[model samples]
Target: MFRNRDRSAETPAHETALACLEAGIAATLPERVVADRIALDEETIAVGGATYSLDTFDRLVVLGGGKAAGGLAAALADRLGSRLDDGCVVTTDVESGSVGPIEVREGDHPTPTERNVEATRTILDRAEAATAETLVLALVTGGASALLCAPAAGLALSDLQATTDALLASGASIDEINAVRKHCSAIKGGQLARAAAPAPVVTLAISDVVGDDPAVIGSGPTVPDGSTFGDALAVLDRYDLRETIPDPVVDRLERGVDGELEETPDAGARAVAAAADDWHSLANGRTAIDAARGVARERGYEPLVLSSRFAGEAGEVGRVHASVAAEIVAAGEPVEPPAVVLSGGEVTVTVDGDGTGGPNQEFALAAAIELAESGADAVLASVDTDGIDGPTDAAGAIVDRGTVPRDEVDPARRALAANDVYDDLDDRSALLRTGYTGTNVNDLRVLVVPAAD
Candidate 1:
């Protein structure tokens, strides 16, 4: 399943690390998780621990957007067969396509575009036409925030693009970034459910945020939003983004905060109350971590799951992982050597340099430096589960004691400081490229420590 499996200068430990990462990524595939949680019988359809009878609705419509929406819809089509009347979803993956009654439309990611706006209009139109008798199966996941763009009144696609670019570059947390998105979008923050008012909407999600908050995932199109316009404005102030944000975005947010405009539906809103019992969003970081631990054991390494909610700056997290490996080698306090430590979560990078590198690349380079200084023999690898880390082509990077030569230590330090780890890793053949993994669950990090010699 790994595309870059063969490369020169391969170490046995490097191969093991690659296997561990591939295993974790594979475990989060949309088809695998969707099949496990969704199923159908003759007259009854089950999803996320809830059962809905086919006889309860006059029509079954599938609607959603995300990185995994294509696969999720495919799996549902297989199970639902002819019962599915129609379906449509937006995604960034070009390989995604329609199957049966579902059509997976293309959309730009990390930034909203005109094509995205047009495609989203169709989704909203279909949703708005739904009635109480329509059974709506909603797929919400990572990338949906951008893929399902529907700018609020007075805002253009340019406004959304500018705001998104600034927010992503500001190193803001996903929750904070999404709070702003929900308020500016017409279909987000429970508006989709409102559009399909009085209909029974069941949502199946693949979480990519740290806390797995359903309202934060894909900006909560089918779930109730707890954030308000005031919260969105606060995020901008916290990041000092008021000056850089487009004028229209600022105006819209300010107007909503002052009650001059309507707010996105909150948990107590009537729109959410109408379809409260019929919604669900499942699949999270733990889903991948659990599967990864199993793979570690199969590979003959004692596994230590650090935490499923790991967060912080990428470089600092990398150093901490190195420190833990050093402790295992020196004191054996946490666990003996020949152990694989696993963690999953999204990490941020505060970009100050014009260099090209993502959070995972910075993490690996910083960890390599720490391991070299501590004289620790360990292999550290990290990758965004989506197969795209920041604006780079490599999924992430891997490093070890021998990754940086003794004489080149100073140069490596300079590269990391300049945020140019991508060039350095590429020169050393350390980057891992698997293209788009067809699923996203934030990031997966692994530290492999050898047994004491």
Candidate 2:
């Protein structure tokens, strides 16, 4: 029997399999893979052969929120050393051993809370206090939208909360949800950067959004935003969220739309186009592919890297990949046997059934059902790099032909509901958990298509 209690098959390379899964995940996160790629030394922060003087600023303050922000800040503090002034960062993971002069606070993810609002206010205050001589190193990573929350002016907590809930439940994509959220918040949509004008803002981005749009990544807290109140209203309209919004939310958005308030900083605006601002990308989805390719070479398998920017509905994406992997496992057509198919990107869950799993979980679960129903010979794992997927603590899940047993699963029924895979993979002890990785690139998935016997 395998290490699993009810294991039907055992591979001598299970440890290697687990290592590949972990490495693939680590490769996606920027902070984990970027330190070596960029010159982050004690004296300066350098990228692309250009160096920024670290000691020129009178005070160095780090402020941001995300699943990876804590770890990334810690790495920066480690690199900055004595140059770093008092620093505070909020993240889902509370890592204690950060570089130095930095404070870590835990925040909720995938959903905002009263504490999230309060913590964000604190971060804003820190940003606002920065002077011309101060250098603000903004570490914006994945999960930031929920980790840091602040309602826009005249918007109450209840209003923001209600609007967010409705938008998420309405099958809206992240881009759409963020458009609404950026308008509804004070810190998002480049408002954070505008808040700390004259003070140099160097943004270190670990992009989880597709196409790597800075304005959409964590709603562009430290970068300039192009999203407007009109765009936000359009998102709400496109999703038919007008009638569903709370009265207070409708009123607040109406006020903004009527020019009663200023919109988030516009792109190409003079203030945002200044040389005082610096933006550098540490890593992204491609890093995961690189990591998987190296592992594939070591494991003696041909590695085929699909797209790193795969998106759309999570369950549907899983079905497509599962079908391809199944064909390779059974018939050995596309790439051959003993091959691994690797993909990395962020996927969305529309929240119809309000199931507990995230995009990765939904993908794994959907794939599991597909494998189980078809009796495929493939092994697979799907995991979020930050170790938390959706509302649940598990980053993601793993599966094979032994997922739910052949004659058992109601395949069409489960995938119809979003992320119901958590229910099935939970029984197999395949849920991957690593707490918080401190860095996030997005989701990483690997499939093992063993040779046909």
Candidate 3:
């Protein structure tokens, strides 16, 4: 699946890291996850061990949004075939080929657009149309929050845009960022389930957020939201973004806090509890990290899964990973040489410089600098599982001792300082561009170290 398959073919360590990455990406394909977890058996549909009798429902409508919605819809179409009456899904990708009566609508990502609002409006309409006899199969996945944007009352798309910009640039955690989103949007934070109330709503989710909280994944359109407007306001204040955020957003949040605006349906809300089913996480970061570990072990390396819940600043994470790799090389501790270290989680980047790079790119860049400084013959491979890291086209990058010559370390450091890791990695032919992988599970990172000669 790697377009530049031979980019790291010369180095055994790099080859192992790249192979592990491929294994991870392949494990979480939306169709594959759906096939493994969802099954249709005549009057019965089983999702993640929960079986629903099809005889009870006169109609089955598929509704949801995300990066993997199209693929998930296609898989469901094949499984359900003619049983699917109507469906609509919003996604960031172009309308790729879909099956059955499901319609795929395009939307923007990392930021919501007017088109996203329209698409999400249609999705809400479909949800609201669900009758008592209708079974709503909702596909929730990563990127759904942005793709399924429907502004709350008194809020415009531009308001959402400005608020999103401020929150994203605030270096907040995903939970914190999504807390604000859940409160501001019309359909998010269990509103979709509320719309489909009185109808059974079954959700199959591909988790991209840490902790796999249904409320956080895609901002929990189907499940109940535990976050409140107060939480959103606290997030803004935590990031010191209260003053800079759009006035409308601040007003909305303040109104919500003051009980002037309605809050998102909490976990105990009847609408949320009535229409929602036992949420299923079809795939997640652990799924990718486990598959990668298997590949690493198969390649004769002792694989150490550092953590599937790794978080924090990308650069700091990178340096910590580098330190672990150097330890393996220096003292043969933590399983010795010929070891592959792996982790899967989302990292943050406090973009101080107007440079082009995402968290994974920054992670790789920082790791490269650390390895070079320590004179460690280690290789690092980091990539967003969805194939797009941050705002850049490059999925991520690979770095080894040769990625930067000893004399050029200064320039690499400068690039890292400027958050311009993309240009540096691109100049050295290290960026990995795999296009859309039809799935997302946060990020996959691998650090490989070989024995000294």
- Which candidate achieves the best TM-score against the true structure? 3
Task: Residues 274-337, candidate 2: write the lDDT tens digits.
Answer: 4224776677767766787788768888888867888888889988888988788667767886
Which 10-residue span in candidate 3 carries the lowest summed lDDT? 90-99
Write one digit per residue (lDDT tens) for candidate 3, span 105-181.
88888989988898888889988888999999889999998899999888899989988887787789888988999
* Candidate 1 lDDT, 1-453, residue by residue in tens: 556677722766677778888888887888788667767776888776778898989999999898888878888888888889987898877654688888778887878888788878988888888888998888898999999999998988899999999998888988899999999999999999889877778888899988878888899898888898999999999989999999999998999899999888877877565555665655777788788788778888899999888777889998999899889889885988788899989888877677999999989888888888888888989999889888887899888877777778899889877878899988877888888888989899888887777
Shift in Å, residue 258, candidate 1 = 1.3
* Residue 63, candidate 1: alpha-carbon lDDT: 92
Q: Looking at candidate 1, what is the lDDT of residue 142? A: 90
Off by over 4 Å in 2: 1-9, 12-17, 28-31, 95-99, 275-277, 415-419
Poorly placed runs, candidate 3 (over 4 Å): 96-98, 274-277
Please report the TM-score between candidate 2 and the true structure.
0.91
What number of clashing residue pairs does each candidate have, in the order they appear? 0, 1, 0
As a whole number from 0 to 100, the lDDT of residue 385 in candidate 2 is 72
| Candidate 1 Cα errors over 4 Å, as ranges | 95-97, 274-276
Worst 10 residues of 1 by lDDT: 1-10
Provide the overall lDDT of each model, using Cα atoms, as 2-decimal numbers.
0.85, 0.74, 0.88
Please provide TM-scores, in order, for all candidate models, with all chains considered together. 0.96, 0.91, 0.98
TM-score of 3: 0.98
Order by lDDT, highest first: 3, 1, 2
